[model samples]
Every structure is written in C-alpha cells, then in structure tokens.
Target: MTPAEHPQPNAPADPASPAVELTPAAAELIRVLSAVHGPLMFHQSGGCCDGSAPMCYPRGEFRTGGSDVLLASLAVEGLDEPVPFWISASQYALWRHTRLIVDVVEGRGSGFSLEAPEGVRFLIRSRLVRQPAS
Candidate 1:
C-alpha cells in the first residue's frame, strides 16, 4: 500500500481526543507570542498565588523536572513542534481525570505569565472526562 494509504500507528481516530484544547483567541495569541518569544511553553502548578495560574514562557526558560507531568501537546499555528502543556506531578494527580481546555480572556493574570503584558491572560478550564459505561 502507498504511504498515504498505510494506517498510521497509534493515531487517534478522532482528532478531538486530546486532553487539552485551545480556543481560537488563545491559538492566535500563542502564534503571536511564539513570534515574539521564539518558542513558548506552558506550566500550571498547584500552589498559592501565581502558581495556580497557567504560566507561559519561552521554551527552556522554565525547566520541567521529574516532578512535572506533561498533560498535553497542543498544536499551534506557525510552530513546528506542538507546545507542551504541563502541570506539577502533584497537580496532575488531582487533575488526571479531567480534560483541560486552555483559553484566553481579557484581563491581566500573573505578571510573570507572558500573556500578562498583552492585556490578556491564559487560563485553564477543566471538566471531568466522562467514562464509558461499564
């Protein structure tokens, strides 16, 4: 069979199966941020204050260690690699069963998050993933 006709291994049959998704506004902002920051990444930690907010940084600026869990890889326009969305391992433990949706709103979040300077913020909205009936 030709390459196009060959079945791709381990590919999701449904394109929307990912645990995380981005809103149109968020995707556009990510594209803009990637242009300014070169490449970007996001991390959300379970902590007080700013740590609870989703933080975006230029890739490699924020180091992910063993304590971090990669929850999803998001496809953004103009970026070759899918942007990684991570959370602290502990945070992931609490959120593991939920689907995270990354979105943008008109407001300033933590000043440290890259989007803060743009008069907007990136936030995560989550919902429990429905289980298949037994």
Candidate 2:
C-alpha cells in the first residue's frame, strides 16, 4: 500500500486515507458476509433511524448512478478485494467534511442489509475532518 493511502508508522499526516473506513469487527463481519453473499457494497442514506445506517448489499443488487457518490473502497483483512462504500449525493454534500467509520454492533439489522440474519448491524460513526489551510 502506498504510504499516503495506507499510512505506516512515522508517515506524514498529509494525504491521509479515504474519507471512510471500517472497524476491525466490521471488517471481520464483512469477510463472513462476503463469503455468503459474494461481492458486497455499502450505501448510506440521508434519512433517520435504520435509514441512516449504512446498508450492505450484494454488488449489482442495488443500482447506483450519478446520484450516488462512491466514498471509498474499504479493505478488509483476508478478503480478496475491497468493499465499495457509497453515499447518497445529497448526504455526501452534508457530510463531505467528515470521516465516516463503519462499525458492527449487536442489534437487529435492517431487513434490507445482508447482516440482518447474523444478528449484528453496521453503523456509521463520523468525526469532523480538519481541512488543510491553503
């Protein structure tokens, strides 16, 4: 991995990783989910409650177009490939300056998300990103 894309010890702080990432638990769970569901993608909506939660779907099952923004392709350890994370364009407009983290928690997941049957759900947590002074 490039030092800028995947930071190593003592690496420069500038040119950090993507705007979104996955927690270890979330990444492990993704390894399980992807094994059963094949390739996967994540989409977060601008709505409330579960609607606001990031929903993981089998790739191609959910149609994405210009209205959706591809935030990042998150890497999960032991997985053959990265998972694409997407957000509604309008939601991106509101959250563009924040770093989004996907975490897995014990709960009833949305029926639409593949993780629902596993008794765990994916949640989005955010931290404000400081813009570099020009």
Candidate 3:
C-alpha cells in the first residue's frame, strides 16, 4: 500500500479475534504519534497462527500501514533514552492492568525484554522509525 493507504481501525486484529477497542488511550497514542512524523504504523509478527496485535512504530518503518490518529507526549520510565509515544489513556490503563511493558528500541541491536513470572519470556526488537523527507 502507498503512504496514503491505511488499514481500517480496530478491525478484526488477528488470530486472537479479540475486538481491539480503539479506546481513548489508543486514540491519544495515535494522535500524539502522528504529530512527530508520518502516520503511526502498527505491526504484528509472530507465530503463524498467532494473529498480530497493535504495536505502533514511527510511520513508514514497517511494511504495513495504519490509520491517522491524534497524538500526545508521554514518557515511559526506566528507558535509557526518551521515547515519545502517542497513546490513549485507556490503552495505558490496559497496559497497567495487564502488566505489559512498552519499550523504545534504537536499532536492530537493542530493545527490551518481557519476563513474565510464569516463565513466559518475549524478546522485543527495536527499530528506528525513519523520518519522512522534507
């Protein structure tokens, strides 16, 4: 898809079939992200059967595309570098309740890891979202 094309919002996400609510938090996240550069792109790549979920990166960085949304300035602590995220309050709430940790990665070599108490571990990769040319 071209830059103008974007995926429909919060549609049947993937394998999970969990109707993703474009909650206020998510909306805010979108809004905030759009302001920095290109439209935010949410990507999911995992097991063959496991449908992907919504995870936004700097627009145009991922192969897929995403709809336009609002943006805000929020800081996630514990990160070595500052990451500007556009997210809704409800999404943030979900992260809080779910104990999900969002992180910012600089390049192919760096990122955070998810260590769940139940021995569930996820190695999250990081990529720099390219800035659109002037």
Candidate 4:
C-alpha cells in the first residue's frame, strides 16, 4: 500500500481500551520488515536514544519481563499471529489513561529497531482518554 493508503483503525478501539493501534503505513512497513526478519513485535521503553519511539524486533529477540506490560496485540498481514505490543510498566503508568497510535515516519530511528536500517522509524502519538461521566 502506498503511503497515502492508511490502515483502517481497528474496530472497537476507544480511549478506555488499552489496545494500541497501527496506522496503515505502519502496518505496511511491518509487513515488509517481517518478510526479512520473520515475526515481529514492538516495545516502547522509558529510556533514551529513540525517545519513546516504539522499537521493533524479531519475535523473541527482546525479552519482556515484570517491568513490561503487554498493552495490545496487532494483526498484520503476512503474519500468522497477532504481533504483541508492550510498554514499560513505568511508562504505562504515565500513559494508562491515553490511547496510543503507532505510526511510521521517514528517518533512521534506533539502530536496535529492525526498521532503522530501512530509513524509517516507528513512533507513537498518544491522546488522553476521556473518562466516563461520574
């Protein structure tokens, strides 16, 4: 899909939902990366270098433990199972009330992220979730 072709937002995703999302461009790129790297996953760390940019890795490359929270599983084409998306437990606390929109931008991001070699980066845009009326 071309950059103009945006991925359809996953249905039933609302501010109250913890499931993260991927833009069409982001999904398409993931498909391409998967072709070369096999299954993929994402982790948003509360550290430097990428500045909270979502880091993509081959499944099982990055170990997730108690400090990380599995926020969502994304279904992308070319992959048999949904890709897992995680955030640092500490970061999740700060973003617990928001919805994360994962997107792709043109540039080399963290070298550790597989997509970095492709001259593209995965970043997240978040918005606060509106609490229900009390």
**Best candidate per TM-score, number?**
2
Predictions ranked by lDDT, top down?
A: 2, 4, 1, 3
lDDT of 3 by residue, 38-134 (tens): 4444443332321222345664464432332222223323223333333333332222122123333222222221112213222222222222223
**RMSD each, Å:** 6.9, 5.9, 15.0, 8.4
| TM-score quality measure for candidate 3 | 0.30
lDDT of 4 by residue, 24-124 (tens): 99999999988898889998888876857899999999999878877788888667888889888788756766788999999997559998888889989
At residue 41, candidate 3 shows an lDDT of 44
Query: What is the per-residue lDDT of model 2 for residues 31-124, given as tens digits with 9 covering 90 to 100?
Result: 9999998989998889888999999999989888878877788887888888888888788767766788899999996559999989999999
> Which stretches of candidate 2 lie above 4 Å from their native place?
1-14, 131-134
Q: Can you write out model 1's per-residue Cα lDDT over 29-105, one digit (the tens) per residue? A: 99999988887889889987657878999888998987887767788877898898878878765665567788899
Candidate that scores best on lDDT: 2
lDDT of 3: 0.32
Which is superior by TM-score, 2 or 3?
2
Give the lowest summed-lDDT range of ten residues in model 2.
1-10
